[model samples]
Target: MIIQGFYNIIDKTLALQFAAPDAMKDPFYVDAYNALNHFTGSQIVTEIPLKEMQSYINIATQYASQTYNLQWAFSVMMGMGAAMNFSMAYGRRNITKMKELSGNGFTSTILFSCITAFGVFCIVYPGWNAVFITSQMGSHYNVITEHLCWTYTIPLLAAAPLMFLSYFFMSMLRSEGKMLWVVLMIVSSLLVNCGAGIFFMHVCHLQLSGAMMGTVFAWLVQIIWGLIIVFGVKGSYLKFGWKDMLFLKWQNIVAFMKAGLPNFINNAALVITSFALTTLVVQLPNQSYNNGISILQELYSSITPWMTIVLSAGIGLTQGARSIIAYNYGAKKYNRIWQVLKRVSILIIIWFTLMLVVFICFGGLMMQAFAFPKEYVPQYRWWIVINFMTYPCCAFTYIALTLFQGINKSMLGTFTSSLRTFLVILPLIGIGYAVSMATGNPIYFFVFIGLNDLISSCIIVPILVHYWFKYRQKLVDLPDDFRSTSINEETFKDSLEHLSKTEVTAAKEQTTPPTKKQS
Candidate 1:
């Protein structure tokens, strides 16, 4: 929270002081100012009171505050939870069995986490530069060219090592005896990040650049920590063998692609669709809509880092919960598994509901804190409220998808996400663009984004219902004693009673035969 707040303060201070002035006097700024002036037709700049401005800033700050704390905590908690779950699930198994498995739960979690951190920084760095340079140059033109040039490339390069080290820790977590070591590695990396971020990024005046540099430096520290664990740690389970590497199986790669490719496609398509919608919005006659989209994008970027936290924690618990339930079902403990699944499902729903409420209630004030140019505030507020309503639907999908993964029916999970991205989001964007352009109503764009999730829910709810019924039907078809058919208790008791009766008859016959011999 502190690190995030520090960056927020620097960004707000610099953008307002440097960018806003240059933007006002300069023609480019004049053009933007005029465009907004024409659309709003109110002298909003001076008309808005300081009290409102302060209120906006306070709300925006709180949103950033929640996002920063939630994201970091989420990342840490998810990493730890994933590590623990992977250990408990696969730890006791032989290496051969472990190698054959595809999920590599710990590895996937860590890699995505590292990628998320890197992406967050990469995505934020560009916008940060935009804020700074636009403040300095008084326009948004050169920033794009500079982004293509050289200023932002280092952060992208820095992200590579973070991803690699994440892979390594994930591997270590999967290895026979290194849970504690992996925990230490993560802790050490975080400490380095905290110290450097506070000193260099905050105190030393590097701003966003320093923030990126500090994160990269933390990865470097983590890489060293990984090497120490790989080389120095010694134990019976830690016999570092070259054999496994000599014959890396292709099946692992295939399995990962099967499970992950859909998700990748889902996100990539969403990004493309978002870009298209933004372009459409920018083309709108309303300056407020265009400017609103721009600022909202930045606020959205700020909130994205914490998605790792939400997904990580949600995915971890769901994976563990599903596995336990699925195993019991496989062992024919039908009643027990059914009871457990119901309880867990209820808890997950409650948790998701709470998150929805928080984001919806506090979203606007949060966007305001980013302190976008004064002219665009109205549109920004509307979009913030509209954009976050998708959270509940997203959370539900995430948990459901994890459950599908658990049951080895991951295809269904992939399909659900695919439908959400391509079918729901993209189409709604097209409709939004068409409606907004034809009618000259910018609110349609806002309405469309919100409607997409509702549509996604419509599709998803039925599928989930079908899944429940299909599984329920299978349960009803099971035989009464199918659960314990391995030992037939009734048949064994019947055999014992017959055997006793036969023995009594044989004894009576033996006594009669002895009397005839005597005669």
Candidate 2:
């Protein structure tokens, strides 16, 4: 996950580089200019002013990044189906069910990706002007639309299906306890993406379109690599075949959707919140803030992907722990679940603490690396400091969400996931927008956004505590025969093996019948 995050950072930096004065030399820009001229049937000037061209590229890149994020959120949503279902099936030792689930999950994801890609394509191509005309960047609408249509939207959407498949394969691999394989897939893809990106953007001068093409190629590589590991590799615990793919069932599809809905909502909420905040930022009434819109947007675009990198650590930990917790929960090893939770909590705390320290100490340098003016570094540093003030609360939310996912409490997970975004930060955004309007100062908006986690924690922490105690007591009260006394790794493995063997023997006996009854 961290490797993937660094890929995003590098990808964004590369895209931003084309916003320079010399960007007109890029083939992508020239092609877009020609295409727009042909479509509009007017000889638009080739020599657009350098600063104006830079602004167009900068804004286009920011919006393009947002579109990519939205696509990724949907991919994560679809991938969760395989992750949860396959892990649960593994816990129950139902190898057949796991294969069926994986096949059904992949099919459903592909169908959904096709629909989503088409929908987005319609919006970007024919509907771009109508959709964004009312946006806050009133005068720049035409430039934004043209850049997005030619460079980012068309190229990226073309590979949406492959991207979704990549994520689906990743989820299935993760559920099968193939973290090493997953890491390899991600690393290989990132290296190819970076290498391809440089070749396209610098050697071929494809600009942003080249970067999008590189992304598509990366997804394809990841999908092929994952397929090889799953099917070609020997000694894999799960078996998947063509029969599994052909035998689709409505029950299986519904189950996958049910299991994955919470994750979908969780990620979708982030994309929506980001969009809302960006819109609000553009609409701020302060003249000073309005004058600095370019800087503000650029800063936001730079900071968010890196912040996602920080948060992805916690998310990655939760994902790893959730698989173990889900398996144990299916095996009825309640004591082991608590033990895993405790260890995860400790690790999350350590990780977030180190991150907080890093953000505080080097926030200015981080902004400087993005080429921000020295005079503005102090303000950017404050943004990081205030935004991350409640960073510790994220640990609790992640643990709670993980616990909910592991135990199959999708509604609880959905609610908890939405709490920070919909219930807390969104309302705060509205209030902050109003406050900024009244005071003619946009700092209030940042402060309100920073308060999101802290305020949500007031609700999330209690719910998490209550459930922790409830589950702990439930474990203590379980019957002796059904409960395991020890929480060691060996005991857990032995219990699972014993149960699996017993189940196999029972199945054989049922199928064999009683031949001796004839005597």
Candidate 3:
């Protein structure tokens, strides 16, 4: 996850470098381009002017990226259901149930991917066009609309299904304990994305279209690799065949929907909140200050993913542990869940604390590496400090939410995740925007952004503590047989074999014709 995070940062930096103004064509941007080239040392000729590129990239990609993210989140929810169901079935030594769930997951991915692709097309193309036209957003808005319609629409829609499938496959693979393979798949795809993007933009001079093309190509690679592993790999426990694809159970689909609800809410809320923030930033009274604030917000947004690498680590730990927790819970081994939670908590705290220190010490250097204006580095450094002040709080929230998810407590997980975005951050952003306007000071806006997680933590941590106690007591109250610490491998294998025979018998019965009625 850490390596993926660093790659993400590098990818973003490269995208900017490739979009930079051409020094020869625009002598005015020569100095700025030189500065950027000093950092990136790139020889690629870019046509987009620096003044226009930042806002263009930020706004144009915002809807496409977030829309895809929302879709990915939904697919993740489906994937989580598949993973948890498969893990639990494995715990019960029920081979039939495991195969059924895996099949249903694959079927769900196909249906959902098609729907999401269509939805994305509608939303980004016609839906946004209608919005721009009706709002009377003027000539600049028209340019943005044109860019979205012509440049981004096709590639984004094309990639949606491939990306969704790859993500679902990764989730299933993770459940099967193929974490190493999953990591390799992600790294390979990311490398392909960057390399392809560089080739298209530099060698072909296709610019934004080239970048989107790269994304499409990368997802294609990922889905193909995922297919080979899931279907062709020798040791994989979970495999989906054509028969599995043909059997779609409504109950299983509903279960996946229920399982994924919390994560979907979390992702959707984030997209909405981001849209809200962008709206607020663009509406500031002073155009100069507004532009500055926009740049700041963009920089902050770019830095946020890297800063949250620690949070990603926490999430990764939770993901890794979730299968164990789900499996143990299914197997009636309550004690093991607590053990996993304890170790994950300790590691998360240590990781977050260490990263916080690093970010505080070296944030300015990072800012410089991104080619942020030297004069603004001091201000940006302060933003980094303030923004990350609540890392520990965020870490705790993740632990709490993941625990809820692991145990299949979607409501509790949804509530916990929603509190930070809707109950805390959104309100703070609104109030901060109002205050900034009233006081003629933009600092208030950022201050509230920085403080949101800390404030939300006050509510979240207590809930987490309360649930921790409640669940722990519940675990303690389980029967002795249900609380066993060890599994009997022989008994487990016997049960699996028995279940497999039962499934075959059931299948034969379903396929056989009924006897003729007696005269």
Leading candidate by TM-score: 2
Question: What C-alpha lDDT values do all the predictions have?
Answer: 0.47, 0.72, 0.66
Could you give candidate 2's per-residue lDDT for residues 21-134 as a string of tens digits? 346654556555556446344665555444445545555665666567777777887787678878877776665677777777777888888888776665555345534222
Q: For residues 1-519, could you state the per-residue lDDT of candidate 3 as single tens digits?
A: 464444435444555567443222444334444444453446544443464554444444444445555566666777777787787776766665677788878888778888877765665565356442212222224343245434544666676677667767777778778888888887888888888878876787665566677777777777788878877987565776667678898888888887777767776776666656656755544434322224554555446546536655766777778777877777777778788778887887788788778889988887655545556677668777776777666767667766787788888888888876677889888988899899887667778877877887788788877866777765642443422223444667888899999999999988988887721
Better of 1 and 2 by lDDT: 2
Q: CA shift at 471, candidate 1, in angstroms? A: 2.8
Q: What's the distance in Å from true for residue 151, model 3?
A: 2.5
Alpha carbon lDDT at 421, candidate 3: 64
Clash count, one per candidate = 6, 0, 0
lDDT measured at residue 131 in model 2 versus the true structure, 0 to 100 = 48
TM-score of 2: 0.84
lDDT by residue for model 1 (1-519), tens: 112223334433333333233223434334443454464545434332333223222222222322233234324333333333333234233333333232343344445556655544543355555332223222233322233222223453446445444544433343334546655665666666566655654466443344445555666776677656555765322223455434444554345445444445554554455445434544554544223233433444334333334444554455445545444434445455556656666766765567667656765554444444445555465565575566566655655554564444657866776666677777787887688878977667767777765677777778878877777645422333332222344566787899999999999988875566677
Ranked by TM-score, the better of candidates 1 and 3 is 3
Can you tell me which runs of candidate 2 are displaced by over 4 Å? 18-22, 26-56, 126-150, 287-293, 476-519
